[model samples]
Target: MTTWTYAELAPDFRYWLREGLPVGLPGVVAVSLDGGGHYARRFEDAPPALTVEATDFLLPLQPPVLYGDAQGLAVRLTDTGRAFDDCEVVFQAESPGFMLWTIHTGPLADANHVVRVPALPDGRAIRMISGVEVTCIENRDFADPTRPERTAVGASRR
Candidate 1:
């Protein structure tokens, strides 16, 4: 298991996806996307700003999450503190790439969610890793406003 803390939300964060994940696998990814609302209950002194936990393969601890196979996984990180209320875990599928998971994190809205990127630059990058091997990496223009054409990973073709 690996934990991503709020402090480590910079530079880069690394986690593993299932090994031997198919390139064209459909609805093959799951994640825990929280708006850091859980941390609000932590009244203890020096409460953690944020933290995300996942298996070595990147499967969420609080499954099963949902994402349409056709959606894209877009993550946006910010320093401005904000509030994130929606939180849950489920398995989802839509198309191949439409916009599966769109993460927006900040100090105020401290977030605890899994992102699919080695280095987060503002909010524009989609990369995939199957097990210990990197399967593919693609950089898209943030201004294009076009969703990706494939989901990140999957066990087998659906």
Candidate 2:
């Protein structure tokens, strides 16, 4: 019974997804679009959370996607190969030309991950795959206002 602002435009829209590994692991978290160069960061200790931008060019190529853990903290999409699944619209809000859409992929993940998506893509849409739940925020606003453009390698966002 949840409502989506953009659902009317694309009723079947679903957010992309990612897997959340246990904290403290050491590895590289990479994100990339079909043609765009990949962005990656290697960490000695896995971070508690991460955020990435769903560029306008790539978004138009596919439906939106999300994956959340417990604690209501949006996560990143670690794996983009998995197909989209049904989800529940937990929250939605209108914001001028854009909107905010939050969904629950299922029970809070074992890692207490969360993913926030503000917005989609097409026939073989330019997909974006990452190594972790993607949290899509409005392009006009910061992913986390308090930590604008701040990324703490191998640190926690708590």
lDDT per residue, candidate 1, 1-158, as tens digits? 22221221123432334422223222112222242111111111233243324321222122212232234442322212322332222223233343333322221234333433223354444433221111111111111223221111212112
Clashes of 1: 32
What are the per-residue Cα lDDT tens digits for candidate 2 across 40-136? Answer: 4334455676565654122311222344434232434332333222223333333332334445454222222335543332222122233221322
State the weakest 10-residue window (summed lDDT) of model 1.
133-142
Clash count (model 2, backbone only)? 30
Q: Best-fitting candidate, measured by TM-score? A: 2
Q: What Cα-based lDDT does every candidate model obtain?
A: 0.25, 0.32
Largest lDDT belongs to which candidate? 2
